[model samples]
Target chain A: MNRVSAIDIRNVTKAYGPTLVLDDISLKAEANEFIAFLGPSGCGKSTLLRMIAGLETLDAGEIHIGGRRIDEREPGARGVAMVFQHYALYPHMTIRDNMGFGLKNIRMNKAEIDRRVAEAARILEIEPFLDKKPGQLSGGQKQRVAIGRAIVKNPDIFLFDEPLSNLDAALRMRTRLELAQLRRRLNATMILVTHDQVEAMTLADRIVVMHDKKIQQVGAPMDIYARPANRFVASFVGSPPMNFLPVSVSEGANGAVATLGDGSKVTTRVKGLTDSASWELGLRPEHVRVSDQGLAAKVEFVERLGERTLVYARLGDGTALTAEDEGLSRVKMGDTIYLKVDGDAAHLFDADGKGYHTPEVG
Target chain B: MMSPKARREFGNFLFVAPYLCVFLWLLIWPLISGMGLSLFKADLFGGASFVGFENYSRLLQDPVFLQAVGNTFYFVALTVPALAIIPLFLALMLNRATRTAAFFRGVFFSSSVLSVTIVTLIWRMVLMSDGGFVANIIGFFGFDPIPFLSDPNLVMISMSIITVWWCLGLPMMLYLSALQQVPQDIYEAAALDNTPWWKQLTHITLPAISRTVVLVVIMQCVLQFQLFGQPQLITQGGPNGASRPIVLFIFEVGFRRWDIGYAAAASQILFAIILMVTLAQYFVASRREGRGR
Candidate 1:
C-alpha cells in the first residue's frame, strides 16, 4: 500500500435542468483516507460521486486529485475507477476479460495485462470463476469481479456508489470487510456514497454527513456520534435514534442547568451565566437513566432487546422521550418511572436545530 | 354423466377446434397434398400419372432451376446482411436523435405497411429502364441511363436494395427495443475504461443485442429467400431468367407451364431451406440459453 493521492473538491454545484440538485458543496479527502458521504435518498450523494467520475457534468466548481485538476477531463483520462451500485460488469465478457478490458484497450503488453488480472483475481479470490460470464455468476461473485476490474486498473482514487446495497445481509457484511481490507492494501483515497449509516460508520476514516443537498457535518465516526454538530446528525447517525426534549437553561456550577418538564433540575458541567433562550436537551438512550430522585414520567411501551431494554416514556407535559434500563430490568409498560439525564453527556440545541456540546477534557 | 374435470377439458378442446380445423385445411392438408402431387407427372387440367422420383431427378439437371437456386442464394447473401445492418445503423442513429427520433422511426416504418405491389411500383418508377427517376438523375451527372432492371447482374442487386429499404422498419424497431433495455451505466463504465466508440459498439452494443441480431438475420434469410413479387412485377424474371429465384421459377413452371410436379418438387426444396434456417435459429438460441445456465 504505497500510493497516496489526495482529492480536493471546491465549491461544486450541480443542477438538473431547473432543479438545483447540489448547491455549493465542497470537501477534501486526504491521501489514503476512506471517506463516506452519508445521506438518505436523493441527497445528491451519488450525483456528486458521478460528477467526480465525469459521468455527470459539474455545473460549477473545480476538482483536483493529487493536485491536478480533473473536473473537465474525460472519464477515461481521470486516474480513477468506480464500482457502480448495480455492479455494471459487461455481460458479454468473461470475468477475466472484464477485469483486463481497460488494459487491453490501452494496448498494454499481453503478459503484463495477464499478470495484473491474475494478481487482482487472486487478491479478490475470484480466480476460479474468471472464465465465466457475468450472467453465469451469482450476485456476490459478480460484485467481486466488478471490484477486481477496479483493482486491476490501480487507480489513485476509488469511488463506490452503494456497492453493497444490492447484496443480501450476510454477503454484504463479508464484502464490506473485504472493502476495508482493500483500503488498507491500496493506500489510495476512496469515496463511498451510501445511505446506510452502519457502512459509513464501520469503514470510513471520516464521514461526510449530507442532507437536503448540503453537507451536514464531517468528522471521525465516534466524534460525530459523541458530539453531533446538529439535531439531524444526532438523530440520523444512531439506531433507535437520539431523543429530544424541551428544557429551560440557566447559569450553573460547571455548565448550564436545565429544568425538566416535571420541574426537576439537573446541573450540567457547561459553564455559562445567562438564561436567555429556549433550548432542547439531546440525549442518546444510553445517556438517560431511570432514577427515583429524577423527573417522574410514565412509560408508554418497553422493548426488551436481549442486550438492553428501551423504554418509551412521556413526561407530565406529554413530551415523548426514550430511555433505557438494564436488559433484565422489571420495567413494565404503563409504569410510572423516574427519569434522569446526564447533563455532561446531553446536548443543547437551539430552535433552528443547531447543537452545542459541553467542552471536551484533555 | 361426465366428471367435472373431463367436462372442462372438453370445453377447452371445443374452444380450439376452429383454429385446428383451419390449420389442417389451409396448412397441413396443402403440405401433404403437395408432397403427393410432387410424386406424379400431373397437369393442372388433365389426367396425371405416377412419376415417383422422375420429376425430382429432372430438376437436378434443369438449367433454369439450377440458375434459380443460384440466384436465390445470391439474393439472400446480399439482402440479408443489408436488412440486418442498415436497420441497425438507422436504429443506432435514431436512438440518440431523441426529439425527432420517433417521427423518423414512423416515417421509415411506413413503407413496411404498404402492400408489396405498391412498394414495387414505387421502386419500379425510380428504377425503370427508360425515363426512370434514377436514370434521369444519372443523366444529369453526364452519363447515360443505366439499365437497372434489364441487366441480369444489376437486377438482383437493385431488388435487394429495394427490399432492404422496404423492410427496414421492423428489424430497426426490434433493435431499438433491445437497445433501450441496455442499462446506460454499462456505456458509462466503458467510457471510464477508455474504450473508443467503435470498440464500445463491437464489445458492448453488438454483444448485448446479439439475440436480436440472430432473430433479425434469420428473419431476413427466410423472407428474402422467397423472392417472388418484386422480380415478377418488375423484372418478370427476364434478362434470360437471371433474376429468377426459386419461388419465381416454381410459379413459372406450375402455373405458367402447367408442370405441377416439377413446381412442387422445387417448392419442397424451398420449404426445406426455410426449415433449415429456422432450425439453425433454434439451435443457436438454445445453445445461448444453455450457456446462461
Candidate 2:
C-alpha cells in the first residue's frame, strides 16, 4: 500500500484582491487519517478545505494528493469529493441518480455505476429513499444523499465543508455520530472543517486549531484542550472561555511566582526573563475548584443548569470569573467564597500572546 | 363584523371582476356576435338580409378564403418556430453571459415595450430592396441586392423575420425570468457530478425550464396565427399575393371590397384552425406534464 500521503497541502495562500483570506497555510494528512480544521468564522478554515478540493485555486503554493501534483487539475480530476455546507443536492434527480451522477459523467459502464450507487446507498442507509427526489427528502436525508454522491465516486480523499451545520441540533449530533462511525468503517483520509468545537473534538483523529490564518496547535483533541499553545486557543476551545488575568512575575530563589491582580500569589516552576517579566495567567473554569485555600471572590450571580451550576462572580480587582459547580450545590448570589485558580494546571502567556513553557512542579 | 361568507364572496368577486369585464366585452361578446352573424349576411352600413346558411354555402366556393386559410397555416408554421426557437436561444445566450447579463437583458426586453407600428416600420425600412441597411451591407460584399419584400418567394421569409424579431424579446424576457427561478445550487450540483456543460444543458436546464418552453410555444403559435401588420406594411401582400395572411385577407374582404359576409366566414375558418392547433398544443403539454409528474 502506498502510505506516503493522501493529501499534502504546502503553504497554500488564497487572496481576493487586496484582502488576504488564507495567509500561508500548510497542512498534510497521512493515508487513512482523519483530520479536522477547527476555527472561528472567516478564519480561512473553509478556504483551505476548498483549496485541497481544487474548487478554489491557490495563489501561492501547491497541492498534491496521492503523490500526484493537482494544483492545475480540475475538481473532477483531483481524486477528491466534497460535501458542501448546503448539501447542494440536484433537485431534478432522485437519490439514485444523484449518487450515480459522477460515475455517469465519467462515462463509466451503466452496470458499474448502478452497482456503486447501490453500494453507497446501502452504506449510508438510504436505499429505501433511492428513487425519491432530493426535494422529497428531509434535511438530514438530503445531506446523506450529498454524502452518498461523494461516496460513489470512491475518492481517495473526502473533504467536508461544514456539512452538518444546516441540520437541527439533535440531527446534527446524530449525523456527527454517523459520520464518525463512517470514518472508522472506511478508513479513508477525511478532512472536515467546522467551527463547532464539539464536532471537531468528537470526530477528528487530530484537530488543527487555526486562528488569524495560521495554525495555533495541532494534536489530538484532548491534548490540545489540555495544553493549548497560546492564549487565543486557550480562550477559543472551551464552552465558557478560559479566564485571562494580568499577573506580575517575580524571580525568587524557588523560581518565578505570579502575583494575581486579586493579591493572591502562586509560586510556579516557570522561569521569566529580565527584559519582559509580565504575563497573563490562563485558567479554565472546570480546572478551578471551589475551596478554602485559594483566592477569594464574591458571587454575583448563579446559573443552575440541572447537572452543573455556573457561578459568575467578581474578584477583588473587579475582574469577573465564572466557576462551574455541581447542579445540586446551593450557592446564593452575592455569597463570598474561596475561588481557587489551579496554578498547577494554569497557563501563562508572554507579551506577544505566545505561551511561555512552564515546567511542572515536581 | 362582516360574516365569513360575505367576506369570501367579496374577495372572490374582487379577484374575478377585472378578468370578467374584459372577457365579456372583448371576448364573449365578439364570439357570440360572430356566431349569430355567420347565419345572416350583413354589410358595413347596417343593412342585413336574413339569408340562412347562404354565406357559409358561398364560403365553400371561395378560392381566396381557401388560399387565406392555407397561407395562415403557412405563416403559423414559419413564425411559430422562429418565435419559439430564436427567443429560447437568445434567452440561453443571455443566461450564459455573466458580465453583461443585465445590459443585454435590458436591450433585448426593451423591444417588447415598443409599439407594433414602430416595429413593422423599422423592419420595413431595414428590408427595403436597394437602400436598406441589410441590402447595403449585402451589396458591400459584392452581391447584387435581392428584392426581399417585392419578390413573391422572399416576402414570406421577410415577414417571418420581422415577426420573429418583434416577438422574440417577450419570450426571451419570459424565459430569462423562468431561468432565474431555477435555483443555482442545481447547476453547481451538476458541476460537482462532473456532468459536461452540454449534458447539463440537456438534462438539467431543459427539464427545469420545460414548462416555460411549452407555454411560450403555445402562446407564440396563437400570436403568429393573427399575423397581419408586418406582411401588410412591408410586402403589402407581396407580388402575386405570396405573403397574404388570413388576417390581411379578412381585412381586404371586409373593408376594401365591402364583402363582410365572406370575410366573416373566412375569419371563422381561421378561428377554427387556431382552436384546433391550440387544443393540440395544450393536449401535448398536458401529456408531458403528466409524464413529468
Candidate 3:
C-alpha cells in the first residue's frame, strides 16, 4: 500500500489472431484501490484483466507493479494472485491443501503455511469444510476456497475475472458484499472484471466503463450513472438505460428552444451547436415524471413490479417513450397519462452520439 | 413398491436368466468339467480310471514342469515391470507433448492393433541370429552377435523384449486415457504456485494415475505368465528348454502326450497361479487406495 502505483499499465495492446481485442489501454491503480472493469460481453474487459495478471501476454506495452517492470515475468513471479471465473479449485485436494498449495510451492515453512492457510480459512469462514474436497463443497463454499487460495498468497494485487458470474443471483449478491468487505479488510489493490452493471455499481471504488476494447469513462458509479461521457456509457450504466429521441433546435429570443416530435417546445440553454441540423435528446426514465404541465401522451402499457412500474407510452409522432412510477399507482394497460420532461436533467447528443455540456439545470 | 412376501424370488431368477445361462455354459461348466477330468486318468477316446491326486503328485516331482514354472515366472518378472513402467513412461511423454500429442499417441498405440501371432512373427525375424536387425546392431558395436533365439542365456530376455513390444501399446493407451482425465487446471495451478516439474509429477501426476498403473501391472502380469507365441515361434522352447513356459507345457501334455489328466492338473496349477497373482494385485491396489485417502 505504500507504493505510488500498485499497477501501472501503459499503452497496452493485445490481439488474438486477426481480431484486435484491446487497443492502447492505459490505467494506473492507486495503492489499495478497488477498481472494476465494467463492460458488455466481448468488450475485452476480461482480456485486459488477464493481461495484468500475467496470464496473457501483452503484444505491445509495459505493465509495472510496485514500481517493478513485470511484462516478461510468469504469473507466479508477478506478485499478483488471480481468482478465476470457474473457481478452478483442484478437484483432488481438500480445502486445506488447496489454500496451502501456493504457499507450499513458494517454499514457506510447514508451520507458516499452516498458519496462513488457517488464517485465510478463518477469514473466508470455510474452516468447517477444511477437510472436505472441493467436489464435496457447495458452490458458495467452493468460491470461498478459491478466494482463500488467492488471499493466502498475500499478493500486492488481486485479479478477478467474472468470479461471481457462476453463482446464483442471491449468492452472487451476498458473495459480492462479502468480497467488498474482504477488500476493505485486506486493503489490497484489487481489479474485477464483470458484465453485471449492478455488481460494478455496488463493488467498485471507481468504475471504468469499456466499449469496443476502449475505456470510455472512469469515475465513481453514481457519477458515471449521472453524467456519462458518451451515449454508450449512458446506455450501459443504467438498469433501464437513458432514453434517446431525435429533436430539432432553433435560436429564440431567450435562448435555444427545442421542439419534440409532438410539437411541444421546451426552452434550454446550451452552448455552441449553432449550425447543427439536428440533435438527439437523452433522459433517464426516473428523471422524467408524469406531471400535468409537460408534453401529453397515451400510455400503451404499464408493467407493475412490487416497488415500481414502467409506463411505456408514445409521443405525438408515435415515437415510443417510457417513464417510472410508483407500483401502488393503479394504471391499467390502456390508461392514458400526462407525461412530463425535465429539460434540465435531459441530455443532448450530437450526430456522432457523443454527449456534451447542457446549460440549464432542472 | 411390491410387498416383500408377495414378490417371489422367481422374479430374480427370471431377471438373471440370460446371465445364468451364459455363465454356466461358458465358464462354470467348463471349469467343473476340467477339474473333474483332472481327477481321473484317461486318453482322448479311451475309458477313464480314478487316479485321485496321482497326477498332481507326479507334477510336484517333475523337474521339467518345475522348470517350466520357473521359466514362466522369469518371463513375467522381466516383462511385467517393462509392460507396467515403459508404457506409463511413454504415455506421460505423449500426454505432455503439446504439439504432436495426438500423432505420437497414435504411433505408440498402433502396435496394440496387431495380432499377437503377427507380432511374434515380425520380432522373430527381427531378432534372428545371422541377418537380424538386433544381431547386426550388436555387430556394428564390435560386439559378438547375440544368439537371441538360440542361446539359453539370451532367449528369455529376447522373448521378453518381444512381449514388451507387442503388449506395451494397450497399457500405454490406458495410461494415456487416464492422463487425459486429469484436469489441466491442476497443473496450471501448480505452475502458478511455482511447483517444479519433477515435484508436480511426483505429487500430482503419479498419484492421479496410480489406479491406471495398478491395472496395467496386473494385466501385464497375467498376460506375461501366459507367454507362448514368441517361444513357440522363435526358440520352440529350445536351448535346454530355457524358453519353455507353463501354458506351452500344458499344451504339450494334453495334445502331444495325450495324457489328459496330467495336462488338466497342470492346467489347474496354471489357473491357480493366475488367480493367486490377480488376487494379490487386487489386494495391493485396494490397500494403496485405502492408504492414499
Candidate 4:
C-alpha cells in the first residue's frame, strides 16, 4: 500500500500444451483497492494471479500497471511483489537477510536497504526476531516475515497467492484481521487469490468470482452475494451454497409464475421472460423457513448451530432442500415439517445459467 | 541400592554395551599398546629394548618417511578437491531425472563398485609404459611413448585420476539429493527478484549446501589418507618412493622390515593428523551452523 497503481489485464489467455487454463480473461483493478479472485480449485484464479506477477508467461495478452505496459518487463522490474502460498522464506538466512535479499540482488544502497528492512520489521512488529532464522519462528511469525519481505520492497502492487490456506483456522482468522488492518494502513493496490469465500467476503473490497476458467461475476462483496450473475456464482459465493429446483415458467395473473418440482407455484417479477423455456428456481436456506402451512417436507436432519438450527428436508416429490427453524425448535430426523419460501429473495435461472432476480424490496 | 538416576544411566549404557565392548577390545587396546610400543625399540624376532623417543627422532631425518608424508599430502591436495567439484557439476547436470540421466548415472556410478585390484588391473593396462592404450595414443601423435605409472612426475597424477574416477559416485549422489531438497519454489522466488543464475548459485545454492561441501571434504580427506593398495599394486613405491603414501610406509616398516616400534610411531603421527584435521573441520562447520546458515 506504499504507493498505489492500477492494473489493466487485457484478454490474457493461457494453455498448458493441449489443455486451456484461461480463455480471453481480462480484469481491471483500481489503485488502492483490495480485490480478491475467489474460485474453486483449478479455476484459473491462481494461474491468472501468477501471470500478473510475471511468474508465468502469458500465451497471448498484455498487462499494464499505472498506464505503463509491464507484461514484457521482468518480474522485479514491473514493481510488483508477491507472497507465495508456502511463505517461501530462505531457510539459510535470518529474517533481516531474508527481507533484505531482493534489495541486495538489485544492488540497492546498503544503508537504504537496512533502513527499509528496519522499517518493515517495525511495521510488522517483528524487530525482536530479526536475527532469528525461519526454523525458529512459529507458523504465524514466518507468514508475517514473508509479508514483511514483500513490504520492504515497497512495490506498486502486492500479490498474495492463497497466503492463509496453510494456517490453522484460528490463526487464519487472526492473520486475516491483521491483513485487513494492514490494508487500511498502506492503501496498496493488492490482489489476493483464494478459494475461501468467507475470506473473500470479509477482506475484499470487491470479489471476482471465477469458475471453469472464466470470470463469472465481479462486484462488491454483498452485491455478488445477494445477486449472483449465474448459477455457478450463486453456488460458489455462499456456504452450503444456494439450492436449486427444476421449475416450469408460464404467464400468471400478475407476472411469470414458476411451478416448482413439488407442484407449488411462486410468483416472480422477472421482465422479458422467455416463454416455454426450461427454468430453475434458486433458493437460499434463510429464504426457506419452517411454517405451519406450506409445502410439506420430511426432515432428514437438523444441525443445531449456536445461532440457528438448519433443517435438511425433502419435498413430496423427493426434491431435497434446506430450511431454517428456530434455534430452540425440537426438529429432528424422520419428522415431517412444512417449509414456506420467500419468493422475493429467490432467483430464476434459464438453461444457459443466466440469472434473473427479484427486485429488492424497499 | 543404587540411586534411580544411576540405574537409568546404567540401563542406557547397557543398550550400547555390545558395540562398546568390540570397539574397546579391537580398537582401544591396540591404540594404547601401539602408543606404548612406540617408546621402545623392538622387532618381530624378540630383539627389544627401551629406546624412548629415539625412533621418533630418527623418523624426522628419514628421507623416505619425509617423501611419503609429502607425497601423501600431494595426493590429498589432488584428490579431495577433484572428487568434490567434478561430482558437483556432474550432479547438477544429472539433477533432472530422465532416461538419459539414468543411463549416464549408471555409467558414472558403475566405476565406484569395482574392487581396487580390478581397478588397478584395468588402469595398469592403460598406463603401462610401452604398449599401453594411452602410450599408443601418444605415439600416434608423433610423441615418444610416455610412461604413466613408471615416471616419477606422472605416477601421482595417474593414481589421483583413477581414485577420483572410482570414488565419484557417493559425492555425486549426496549432491543430487541435496539439490533436490531445495524446492522449486525457492528458485521461482529468486527469479522474481531478478536474481541472475550465477548469483543464485553463489548466494543461494552454495550457502544452502555448505554443510555438504564440508562433509565431502572431511570424508574424502579421511578416505584418501588410507591410500596403500593402489600404489602398492601399481608402482611398487618405485621411481625413488615418489607415490608412497603414509599407510604404505607403515606396512613396509612393520611387515617387511619388522620394525614394529618405528611403524607404530609413524601410525600414531598419521592418526594424530587425521584427528586434528577432522576436528578442525567439525569445529568450523558447527560454528557456521550456529549462525543459522
**TM-score per candidate, chains pooled:** 0.92, 0.90, 0.88, 0.89
lDDT (0 to 1) per candidate: 0.90, 0.82, 0.84, 0.89
lDDT per residue as tens, model 4, B1-293: 98999999999999999999999999999999999888888999978788999888998899999999999999999999999999988988998869999888888889989999999999998888778888889889998988778789988999999899889999998888888888777777787777888888887887778889889989999999888999999988877899999999999999999999999999998999889888998998899887654
* lDDT, candidate 4, A63-182, per-residue tens: 999999998888888899899899888888889989999999899999999999999899889999999998899989999999999998888999999999999999999999999999
Clashing pairs in 2: none
List A-chain TM-scores for all predictions: 0.96, 0.94, 0.94, 0.96
RMSD, model 2, all Cα superposed? 3.2
Task: Please write out the lDDT profile of model 1 over residues B88-177, one tens digit for every residue.
Answer: 998998886466988999998999998889999999999986989999999889899889898887989998988888999999999999
**By summed lDDT, which 10 consecutive residues of candidate 1 chain B come out lowest?**
B284-293
TM-score of candidate 2 versus the correct structure, residues matched by position: 0.90
Q: What is the C-alpha lDDT profile of model 3 across B226-262, one tens digit per residue?
A: 8877788777788888999998898888889899999
Cα shift from native, residue A315, model 2 (Å)? 2.3
Count clashing residue pairs in model 2: 0
Candidate 2, residues A100-119, lDDT tens digits: the string is: 88888899999999998888
User: What's the true lDDT of residue B204 in model 2?
Assistant: 85
Query: Which regions of candidate 3 are displaced past 4 Å?
Result: A1-5, A248-279, A290-302, A313-318, A357-362, B1-20, B96-99, B290-293
**In candidate 3, how many Å is residue A164 off?**
2.0
Query: What would the per-residue lDDT of candidate 1 be over residues A1-362, giving only the tens digit for each residue?
Result: 54679999999999998999899999999998999999989999999999989999999999999999999999988899999999999998889999999989989899999999999999889999999889889999989999999998989999999999999999999999999998887878899999999999999999999988899999999998988988999999998899888888877778888787878777777553334367887889888878786778899999999879999999888989899888897999899998877878888887778878888898
TM-score of candidate 2 chain B vs. the reference:
0.90
Ranking by TM-score: 1, 2, 4, 3
